[model samples]
Target chain A: MWKSVIYKEWLKTRWFLIIYAAIGVLAVGRIFLKVQHDFTFNEATNFWYVILFQGYQYFGILKFLPALGGLIIAVSQFFPETVNKRIKLTFHLPIVENKVMIIMMLFGACCLLLTFGVVSLFFYGLSIIYFPHEIIHGALVTMTPWFLAGLAIYFLAALIILEPVWKFRFLYALVAVAFIPSVFFDDTITGGYSPANPVLFVLVIIMSTALLFSGYRFRKGEM
Target chain B: MVRLSRYFLVIIAIIAFSVVIPKFYWMAFEKPVRSPFVMYSCVENDFMIQKSTQDGLVRTDTRGNNYTREQYEEKLPLMYMRQLMISGTMPDTINGVFMDAREINDERSTFRLRTRDLFTPDPGLYPMFESQSGRANLEMPDDYFRITWRMEFVDANTNKILEEKSRMFSAVLYNRGFDFPAKSINGIPTTRKSIDEGYLVIDSEDQLFHVKMIKGKPFVEKVEIPEGLKFKHISCVDFRNKRYYAYLFSEENDLYILTQDDYVLKKLPVDGLIPEEQEIKIYADYFHYNIISDGEGYMRSQILDADFNPVDEYSETWPVKMERTEGKIYKFLFPGELSLSNSNSNYNAFFLNLNKSINWLVLSLILIVIQFFIIKRRNEKFKNQIVDFTAILFTGIFGFLAVNIFPNKFFK
Candidate 1:
């Protein structure tokens, strides 16, 4: 039963995941390519000086891509469930309805992890090539929030799309816009978000549960 | 499971609205504060004020006596020396001291300090320039240094450690009574300064040292801080006068200057100056050390004689945001404010600036009643929405928005 559910979700989401991974690779490649070009144009010392003293982030281009990836994955996976009440057919599968919903979301979560993990590995390799441990550590501390923001937005997009009523869905989307962008604050070259990142992480973890209510409401055919 | 999801949604919605609405209210209503520009007059021995008015800018002393432009400049000759020199109306001598623009420029300097200067985190590497390099302009060095377990320098060209130079510097540091690791370091790395004073570094155990590189040699001098004093921040100053190396902000909020007179830490007798949340301006002239602490709605100024004894101290207050009508309305409309960052730090986090006054609770009560009547009109049973009522009571306006957005149809 588990293998069947997993294979079913893969059939639904395989193409979108491929596109997601491609976009991740492209963003990482473009940013590091520009960084390499800039490193060659200026002396290595001068390049380090601007990043260290002037508060410039070389990986700033990767900031919004994670959030966008979350949104796209949610739309691809769940937007189909809302059409023609196709979720009713999904619930009819020979498993506990909520268990099936959890499986689907878990599948989407793994997809998100794989996509972002590839970008993170690329960042690690290129970061060590042109900079010292200090700049590399700064890049890690700075990207922590951006990656978390992407994860949070994914959970939020799931909750918004699973909701049965249009009014509530719009409201959830509105709230997401109002607060989620805050995680990606000013991209300082070094650490500024250390104290705040844990709170945001816990919030997103709690957010992953809110979509269950939307699933339950759809089962009851609430409008 | 359903009940838990509803509660979670309610809480999250309250937080989101709290973050957005109060900030939006202020975005529409906040007014810029107009503070008076003040400088101390050497001739009158009083603080001068240049404030905007309907007529024009009014120039007056703290004593309320007004002066014309020429008279105001004459009263503050050292401050307005260039203007006096440009007009050829400058004094050849004043108070038995010879006066000239060049003399004034060489003898005076300004240093402004903010909280972010010391508190903001940075990449832990610095380029040390040669102080006495015999070059007309300071040049950037090839390596960046980090003082961790021991001093280590990474060659910028290769991004690798120069093991030999690192060993040489660490040896000098160990011999100077320096502890193995440093706690805090502050120095300006740019070449724009008139001179290089290197860095003021506090060792792991609060021992202070002035570290500099001169002609390819290490010049590390341990500064003797007064007993039981610990520094929270050090603002390194490279004044052309060479009077002081830095202004030290102590953990107890005491301000001190590290004087060039054999590295003596001279304490300034002042209080209520928090280096983090206020803008501090220090203007030193031929005779007085004028320190101004500008805070949210008030500003305090003190003048000390050349030897650092208190000469005069004065404080003034102005109406701030909370004192205005728009801010009062904001209190009645929003229960709390949600902010990502503040003036003190740049990091983004959820900052709940709660309105702890009676006004906030009153507004919450009002919003509860409004939500209650709306639910009653919608034919939703009262007992079924106890959770919603509770959310409205605590979250006020945010709670009202959430309940309406999710409408308790199950209760109906």
Candidate 2:
């Protein structure tokens, strides 16, 4: 039953993921391309000076791409389920009410995690092409929260979409608007959020279970 | 399981509101309070205050004495050297000591250390320039060096390690008794300076060594640190006066300088200055060195003779932003805040600062009453809303906002 649910989610979000992966490659590729261009145009010594001393972020372009990937996955997977009460029919399956929704959300999360993982690997490969380990390491620390934001948005989107009430959806959206941008700090400080990275990962985990509450509310016919 | 799921959302919502509320409040009502530029004037033997206002820069003494622009420039000649020199009003001598622009320029250097500089991620690479390259200007080196098990220089153009240069430089360090795997490497690597003082690196054994590349050869100077001393930060300074190699800040909050006079480390007599939280300005001339540390809401200045002995000290205070009416309103509304960084730091840590004012309880009580009205109007039983009110009582407005946003239903 879970396999069937997973297939359903994959079928819904497959094309979005394909396009998202392409955009991810292009985004990460464009960043290194910029570094290459910068290296060619500027003195190598002065280039490192700007990056090291002036806090230049070569990989900063990848900051919002992961977040957009999360949002893309969430909207593609769940937005349609809310139309014409499609999720109600989904829960009418043999699986338990909460289990069906969980399986479906778990499928979206897995797809998101895989998509994000592949993007990160892409980032790692291209990062080493032009930068040393120190710079690559700094970009890795800075981008950790950005990747976590991808998963967080996925969970929060599932929680909001699976719920029955419109007002509650509005409330969740409001909280999310406040919550999501906190992860995308607006500075170029590298490893600035190292202490909060684990805590942010924990937030993503907690948000993963958020679907259960809304799933229960929908099952109880809260609307 | 559903209840616990709801619990998770509630907690996240609380943190969200805590950040959003204070952030929005400040965005709406925040006013910029200009802090007066405070410095010690050796001529008057008092602290001078320069404040910016609607008309122009208002200059005054700490004792409420105002002066014209010309008079103010004459008061602190060291600070207004360029302006005085431009107007041809420069005095030949200040305090009976012969002075010239060249000598004053050599003596003038400012050392600023902010918390952001110490707390951020180190790029772990430095450009080693020729200290005595005899060029008209300092030129950038083709490679950057990092210290791990040994000194490794990476070609800037290729991002590849230079094995020969690494071995050559590492041998200089090894011969000079530098332990492998350097701890903290500090240097001003920019080519903007007229001269390069190279790098002051601390080795694995906590030993200090000054490393420089002069005339295509490694020049290493091992510094003998005072016993039982722990250094917080050390940076090589390229002051034209040739007085000091670097400024060493100790863990004990003392500032020391490695003097060129036989590499002697002199502990400067400074008090009530935290480098991490304040802007330290050491304005030095032939007569006196004014060490001024301007903190969040106060300014403290210490006048030291050329020998670095403390002579006179002055401290002044004004209302910081948080002490104003807007801040008082913020405290009344938000019991605490979840901030990433503060005034002097950009480190993205989860910094939680709670409002300690007794008046913060006012908003909490008002919110509890509002929740009571909300529950009553919704025709919900009072007994079912205990947890909601309890949360509002303890977590203050943050919990109040969260509980209302996430509804709680119960079977009576």
Candidate of highest lDDT: 2
lDDT of 1 by residue, B1-412 (tens): 5667667777777777887788778889898776777888777788998877778889999778999999889888898888988987778887788776666887788889876665577668998889899988888888999999999999988888999989888899999999978888789899887777788899998999988898988889999877889998888888777888899889898899998849988889878788877888888888888888988888888888888889998788888888788878877777777776776666555677877565777877887788778877988788888888888777788988877766666643
lDDT of each: 0.82, 0.83
Each prediction's RMSD to truth: 2.0, 2.2
Q: Which residue pairs show backbone clashes in model 2?
A: none
Q: Tell me what fraction of the real C-alpha contacts between chains A and B each candidate also makes.
A: 0.60, 0.70
Query: For this target, which candidate reaches the highest DockQ against the unseen true structure?
Result: 2
Residue lDDT tens for model 1, A1-223: 8788888778878888898889889888898898878878888888899889888888888888888888888888888878898889978888888788778878888888888899999888877878898888877888888888887888889888988888878888898887676445543436777777788778777777766778888988888
lDDT of 2 by residue, A5-95 (tens): 8888889999999999899888888987788888889967677777777888878788888788888898899888888978888878988
Give the per-residue lDDT of model 2 (tens digit) for B30-73: 98777777677768888788888787899999789998979988
Prediction 1 global C-alpha lDDT: 0.82
Give the CAPRI class of candidate 1.
medium
